[model samples]
Target: MAVTQQLARVSGAYITRCRASAAVSPDADPEWDPPAEDWIDLDWSPRFLRDACELAGVDSPTLEALNYALNGDASVDVSVLSHPEATGGFGPTPTALTPASVADVAAKLAGLDWDRVMAEIPADCRETIAGGDFSGDPLAYLTTHFMALRDFYVEAAQRGLFVVSWWD
Candidate 1:
């Protein structure tokens, strides 16, 4: 089975459920249940994840440092192009994204040199991408998909909401 990456916006109801779930014992709230559904699905392929992560302005020592500082450590960004799982996001999860962090990601993504990013895609990753319809325009593909991801984060952050991203 192929493991495609998935990102979703976490609703307030989901957050409430999470808090309640954590606060209450498992046996207490028979009606309470862990969140199992996603509200906003930003479906991104592993190859896209790989390339976006390495985007010129998107990947920098300073940006990574800030991200690490903002978000603790321990959320795995699984390997897309033979890369190891990345623990702790600059934003939140795989679990959450803050207003500030979402803005940061948007800014970073907007300022990215998409051409440079696509040009830098590793050989193995390129091979993987070649298997799909990614030959048209990498930057365009990234913008279309990443824009959705960015917008989801921005909107969620603005509403004091959180977005949970995980892949199964």
Candidate 2:
């Protein structure tokens, strides 16, 4: 069946279920209450699953196996992904961030060449930087470039040197 047809059928069933549940609920407030039924069913065919997995940049077979392990009809022994050291995985996972590491990150950021870095950044991001929006609030630009700059910093830190400059 076409995806559109499947989606329409799912939507219709969802609406019917919502109306039925709402009718039975005692304190159903139209203003702040959710529509009674929230989830819609979909056929989990291999093609559909595979497309979703590819879009998410994960292996389809691995994701499918994980799903089955998590929710298969017959219960089986399973190990869930968890970090034992952190409560609700809220605290930091163990990793070495020594004084040398701090010095390295600082040195790498200080030594970076603004011209070369600006050239390498995406055109849209460079435009944002050059437009002076970041001039008044440097943190905004830092937040945008944080991931990219961190990667660059890691490589520079490994080599023990980097470059830096200012634009006015």
Candidate 3:
């Protein structure tokens, strides 16, 4: 099964509610909804971005930012927000980035050397992307989703909102 990544910008209060609800019943499937504009579906681009970041030797906040964007930063954990079925029983649970982490990631993404990274992707990960292979124009695809993810973080940071990431 193909796994796709999703990110949602939510308020601290919402996160608190989710945590409380999960604590009450860890197995309950509550309706987890954020506004349309607050969410992004990154498809498999995060894996590509993370791989590209690694190949390019992107460091610290930038590298960490991409990693967190794909896999959560562990700022908050709420198991009820995800289901094993959604992940094909082999994917990460829903995890969040606090507003502070969101701000930090936004700043890091803003300073990322995208051109350099993009130029190095083919040499870095082309035929060795671990679980799967690249399709179409990897550079263009990664660029589109990378920009979207970066913009999503910037917006979330500006609003002082938390970001929750999951795979489904």
lDDT of 1 at 27: 35
Top candidate, metric TM-score: 3
Query: In model 1, how large is the Cα lDDT of residue 129?
Result: 52
Instruction: Give the runs in model 2 whose Cα sits over 4 Å from its true position.
Output: 1-87, 90-92, 122-168
Tens-digit lDDT track of model 2 for 1-168: 322101111122333454455456553311212222321122222233323333334444444432331122122111110122211222222121222432344444444443444344444543344244325433234333433433433443454421110010
- Minimal lDDT window, size 10, model 3: 83-92
Estimate candidate 1's RMSD in Å: 8.4
Which residue ranges in model 1 land beyond 4 Å of their true spot?
Answer: 11-14, 22-38, 44-47, 52-94, 113-140
Q: How do all models score by TM-score? A: 0.51, 0.23, 0.81
Ranking by TM-score: 3, 1, 2
Task: Summarize candidate 1's per-residue lDDT along 110-138 as a digit string, tens digits.
Answer: 55555666667664655455246546655
Model 3: colliding residue pairs: none
What C-alpha lDDT, on a 0 to 100 scale, does residue 38 get in candidate 2? 20
Tell me the spans in candidate 3 whose CA falls farther than 4 Å from its real position.
Answer: 19-27, 83-90, 122-133
Report RMSD (Å) for each prediction in the order shown: 8.4, 21.4, 3.2
Q: Report lDDT (CA) for all predictions.
A: 0.45, 0.30, 0.76
